[model samples]
Target chain A: MKQGPLDLSQHFLEEGVVDLSSSEKQSALEELCAITSKHAHVRDAKAFCKAIFEREKLVSTGIGLGVAIPHVKIPSVTDYVITVGRSEAGIDFDAIDGQPVRLVFMIAASEKQTAEFVRVLASIVKLVKQNDVRSRLLEASMPNEFCSILREASR
Target chain B: MNARTLVDHIRSSAATGRLLILCVIIGAIAGVFCVAFSWLLETVQYYLLDGLAHHESEHPVWIWLLVLPAFGGLVSGVLTTKFAPEAAGPGTDAAVDAYHHHGGRVRTRVPFIKMITAAVTLGTGGSAGREGPLTQIGGGIGSFVATGLRLSNQERRILMAAGMAAGIGAMFHAPLAGALFAAEILYREMDLEHEVIVPSFIASIIAYSIYAQKAGWEPVYAAPHFHFRNALQLLAYAALAIVLAASATLFTRLWRVVRDAFSSLPVPTALKPAIGGLIAGSIGVFVPDALGTGHHLLAGAFASSFSIGFLILLVTAKMVTTSLTIGSGASGGKLGPSLVLGGSLGSIVGLVVQDLFPSLEIDAGAFVVVGMAGFFAAAANTPISTIIMVSELTGNYQLLVPSMLVCVLAYLFVSRHGIYDAQLVSRLEAPSKMGNMLGAVLKTIAIRDAANHTRDLIVVPEAMSLRQIIDLYTSSEQLAFPMVDPDGKLTGMIEGRDIRRAIAEEGVADLVVARDLARPHEVIDIESTLLDAVQRMTLTGLEDLILVEAEDPTRPVGVLEHQEVLHAYDRKLMEK
Candidate 1:
């Protein structure tokens, strides 16, 4: 899925949020919302969690390769937004393996953006599976750098 | 104090805050303890075997074989009976049971007892590998640290994995393999985050460095330089994968047969290993290289000293010895022994192939290395770790492609199962019919008492109302409920949180029934294996399951809870 740089960048990054160490799902949802708001058009955390859970119910989205793609089709989200969060401290996402999740990619897309959304997801999966690309993405210093890496990896 | 104050106080209590810190400290302590245990065992084995090898240098190797194995078996039998009975069998099953059922709580003394007992077993020339005891020792150390630090159940489980990694790394001097070993073999997938990989790497490297510094580096096997000409050889390697896969299946089946046979015996359990040892010892008399863990024979094969005929004999003898040793209840490992056996088998195969086609020369040692990785991958169903391990062991990065191919093929070939059937069984949703039969026999013999006790006491009536469910929950302390419709059709489930949420949000007096709030989720089928249950639970993050008739999910038969299963397993261990 190839999307413009600005759109793809907005899909995955949020700025100025400190690292979270909380184990509660609500706290994680709040953190996710905060980060996602800076990138996409998310109204609130609850709506995001509901959308993600609905998607989860349809399919685990765990993907089984240590990566989980939690996305939502919500009208509140204006554009296709993907937010990537790395938990230095692991969070229990009820991951398929009963193991805590470290890296999370949350996708927010409108109903009309099916093809683009799928392509973006496929690109992310392919990039994440590559050791070099994932390492660079994980080590990106700021929102801009993270966005740049994602754009570069997508290409 | 008010309710808010009490809740805050409980959250900030010294006990709760310390649990997280305890987990980290436990991980570090466990790492150190695993190294110490491994070193201790190795030292004992070295000294004991050093004397025997020296004394037998002047005589025929056959005499030393009989004496060494007999002595090892006797010592193993005596130590198992006198001290730690738990140390008598492969430690992986115990570790797995403890992890799932005991909240990673293992007796601190178990590692020490296992270290000494396993050392005696190996030192006396028992035909078992050391990896099993190492895992138990590592797990015990992890438990010790967790208990000492008072970590939470979740953190303790992580520490258990870290400890296992450390032990495997130290034992084999393969840090990457050790780390992956913990993540892949025990967890059945790479569940830990990339961040945890750093700690696992650090622990494994530290432990392995300490071991290597003290013991010096010992190559797992030597390899003669072999040139790879074309993609054709890679195809040949792929063909060889079939052989490796078949061999791995045979090894696993043989091990199961031996275990089942011995467990079926009416005699005292303590005496079984002695009988096994006698069989292994007799084999060792004819094939001296089959004695002990056979690391020396592996080295010999790599150096091209062992002939094809001798390789055949060693492979057969080693397989039988290992099967008997483990079957008889001797606490040991199969990894090293399997590698040796696979290597020998590969060498023999390579020789026969080369003899048939003299023009197409193939290096036997190279085939041996490929065989080692392929067999391990097939038997363990861990292809990535197997490929990486063989590459690292041989220090031949060039072999990675062939190794990967063979490992993957072998894994595909044995896609049906693994040598560690208990591990596979544990991952299932319910025990198989064979497992049920075994469980029944164990119960009849009163051996089931040692297993962990699970209290699956909560039951829900088909006609219960939502108000009644709420009242029952408020009156009692149960956390889960099985919801059945008026006609006794399995509908869904309601948990403590579900009821509380419904009451808080919708009002308890709204006349909403349990059926209205019940969440219809997938019910675990009766025929589903225990491993399947665990995997599904893990995937869904469900703590309780509704057991329904296999033919129909609408018919509710019983309820199963994660805690109850864990308790039942604990009872099993206690009985043991």
Candidate 2:
């Protein structure tokens, strides 16, 4: 089968766009991983958090401008998946820009998905760099609104 | 050229004289190279980045900014690939790998190629630094001098480390730190190359003094004296350490990512650096401060002149551009860029903490300096030397407490894979040290270690006939059996070879008794090491040795197999 760029919007089921409840950085990650654990790609939320946090230790995915992308590659994951978590009151993520992170995009990829992983990483970095996309994502109130914003951005 | 020893070439009577004279000569030579390399780098960097860019400031010189770095990368890539392939990329790896794996012998032309390539790579606005490549250059100087003199491989490796220390010491103007760095950077853990320490110190101090005498003794960055005031504020420093550690991990991982990406590209190796340079130049067109060795950023950080936004931009841009510069196989070091990135992140952390607490009276510039130490400590996996190096770089000993604390915390927190690809986890893990460690470790284990296995021996009665002994040997797997007297006292031993000879004489199989076939055998004392037993077996052509008490050497109590001694060593090696 031929592989192409993943439609990030299509994967964003409204339920996957979680409103982060915790103020602390560790808990915020836990909340995202927990919410997305029900997906087929993520069988265990604890395991997902463990792998992603281990990677975070290697390098924080906190790209500057209030956005963070915590990602991991695990053998248990069958494919690639993206789970979004937004916080109104930003949490300290040790961001390169010294800004508190408000938007956390948690990505889980199968261990075999090397090329797809890079493409997904590039897409996320590029998508957040767009001023309108980032602003709309931050201001996004409802889960449906979040999905639409990503869909429009992906298009 | 094939002269294998210094004595062969020099015809010296005094070996001590030769070693001392060579040590001093290598240090002086390394010192001179450091000054020359620094001069060439400054001249070229000024021509491309500052001198030329400022001269054409009135026009749209952005094109020049883009072209200059790409051109620099192309020249460096071509030079290294054409002449000395080992001279390519961040140089510390080659130097370190040489000491561990290659017997410290650098190719004759690598040093010369590295110097020129590093100069062009760093000077023409590549976001890499001078120090990393300088290690290879200096190490080459040592290797070359030792090769010419025909020094032993061990002595040659020591000189190589000394040269590395000298180059780093001269460039940073931090002699003590450079000396320590030479020892510390070899391993990822908190271990040092103890043998290299004294030699590195001697070379480092000499190199630092010579460079200072020629280039002035001024510290690289000027800063106001910053002291640790509140013990409570160490919490803030800890936070800074975490941030620095995280950023350091980011720097190393991103560096690898970029390098892998560039290497994996289908283009010829000679042209990959140019592509990386083009992208980096485009970034430089907007944020010009991000290019080169980052002295400007270092200066700004020490002056406490950064807004959070500005510092953040510099940090991000510096990380990306520096990665591109070094990752694309352009010959330069990431150490200097790491210092800048760490300081920027630290400066921002300091600002935020000071604003949040207001009463802590936190000095933001202090964090910049501390960040420099902490970040390098984490990324390079050299904590102790980094603390001193940053202190010496800023000429401020007042912040030693904070610097040391931050460095250690960051070092402990960083990932196992640091910026250096060649660093081993410990001295034991290094191949150069393994051969010598084997015998020394085995000697520590006594025969008593395997005392439990002695109880399961097969004892042959002295009264038993040769036929009975032959039947027992055929049924059981014992190669040798302990022969005993009729009174059940241990006497001697009978091996398979003796049994075979006895049985070959036709009627003797039933005629000879166990006592007749028994031969007086070598015995090992309980106090002896496994090495001793094995050595005896090799010398006497014995398959097994009788174990005797050290106090009673006449009486044989149990048997010790050659295989058991070997098994003991195998278990011990695993522990080591």
Candidate 3:
């Protein structure tokens, strides 16, 4: 597939996992925003990437155990959205434990959707915290399998 | 005291009781100051010209008048210039400026200097009143007390205004009116300094009682007994209001013109008052009653009537002499002169109307009383206080309704301008109130007015590559971008900054998808306001917010940038 619009499933479509082409946190954010632009309603791709990077600059969003959640409240989007970018090769996201990040969850929201934005973030954090879910997400090799695992974990 | 201690003192509730006690002391001091000031001015006049009144010298004793005023002015000028330059002009202006700008601080020496200078000015027949000096003396006492107590600026202002009320109350024996004047005179528009009202009343009453112990508890002016017999008399009073307001407007403008002329004179500043005294002294040579505060003349006008022509001439003479006296920096209050003019104008109208219809029992004294109130209302833009003050001055409460009618009419007629340059339009315009005004503006303005419509935004697809985004960024001036899914459901926003970062990272752009790289931003519904947007923005540390269709949260409408909201706020304020 020449790759349809950057869908939620498309993020994990390539062998159910994405490789970290970027070396560091900043480049990883840039790469993720660039690919996400294929489907996200972003007016400016670079702005979207920089906003997430700016959020990352305050404190490393890399929670630990090879997971990072980078988010931004920007004027460009009309709704809350979540995209998962798996970096199998391991990217230097400056995780709390000083470990490289393997799973990257980038969330984008409008300035007004505060309640939904917060709720979605909490859900994402909860889903990522489950040991079985993390193992399943790490083991999945197909887009359907990853999507099913995320759906179950989210529920 | 150190800054921290001062701040702590101001924050404490104990300061309020301390300030109230201080106000009582200042009021008593101001009352005594007024009495002593009046006595000194009288003594000076007695020594200067009163003794010469019965002189049998071949040379007309009036010849001594020519130099007496000039001499008084010269001495007054020297005293003011040498001791307290702020005490030079009508003291009320200095006191007003002190309250508005100087944190309610006046030099401790000002009241003493003003007393001596104003005494010389009036005693030597400088054609001025005692109220101006009394006002400064009272205000100085308030400042002295406040400074001694180490009170906060707010407490100082209250006491200062109270002191002023005390002085005026003692001088006129009208405590209520004095309190009202202190609160009302600081602003040109119909705004009262409400915080000072209770303190001012307390001070004024104390001062009035103390002063009345010496001056006797009688009204300042005595009027012939009169009653509002018929409703038709209201028409005459209404006419009096219109005419007096016109005269007062003319008087106010002329005073400013004369003051400006004297200000531009090339002579030494100290000699300016002397020159003004010379002209007033020459006029006084003929109409000596026009000199001093015009109290005696104003009293006479109310007691009896002169010919219409003579009364009119007295009005003109009093106006000219007063403008010369105070406008040229002679120490005096325009209040006394305004009362004299109003009385003279009223008596003239009474004479004409009485002559026109002999059947109508039109009391000229009633007109005189009404004129005093209405004229000051026009000049000072203090209708309620002027009416009350005039009634209190004449010891007549029955004339309240008529006086109120005329006072209000006169005030409305010429209230567009005022004699006090230090007067602000209202508390809203005061420097202290600006922060509150800004808060009010932010709270009141809706997002609909502040937001930039979605159609005005630069929209780009979520699937667009970083290279394509860079191309769009260079082409458009938009700072915000709304990302959409394949179904066109609004998914995420990409600020222009993020795109630049992507391009800056070089090779990372090709590998990363826009959806995964996109950051989720807060969305504002169309129905929300700027206050809501600002609150959310502050909470999330965001500068710009996306607006969505109210019916559908997922549908992008417009962008509400922080800068745009601020611009709208500015426009709204300017409109106000």
Output the number of the lDDT-best candidate.
2
The Cα error of candidate 3 at residue B430, in Å, is 2.2
Ranking by lDDT: 2, 3, 1
- Once fitted onto the true fold, the runs of candidate 3 whose alpha carbons sit more than 4 angstroms away are A1-155, B1-16, B53-60, B443-565, B568-576
Residue-wise C-alpha lDDT for candidate 2, range B35-88, written one tens digit per residue: 888889988977777677641244436877788889999999999889998888
lDDT score at residue B300, model 2, on the 0-100 scale: 71
**Which 10 successive residues of model 1 chain B have the least lDDT summed?**
B445-454
Docking class of 2: incorrect
Docking verdict class for candidate 3: incorrect
DockQ of each: 0.01, 0.00, 0.02
Model 1 agreement with the true structure over B96-207: per-residue lDDT tens digits: 5676567777787778777776776666567777776777777777777767778777557666766666677777767788777765664333223232354456556766
Quote the positional error of residue B60 for candidate 1 in Å.
4.0
RMSD of each: 28.1, 31.4, 14.7
Q: Model 1, A125: alpha-carbon shift in Å?
A: 71
RMSD of 3: 14.7
Ten-residue segment with the worst summed lDDT in candidate 2 chain B? Answer: B503-512
Residue B191 lDDT, candidate 1, scale 0-100: 29
Kindly report which residue stretches of model 2 are placed more than 4 angstroms away from their true locations once superposed.
A1-155, B1-21, B55-60, B447-528, B532-562, B570-576
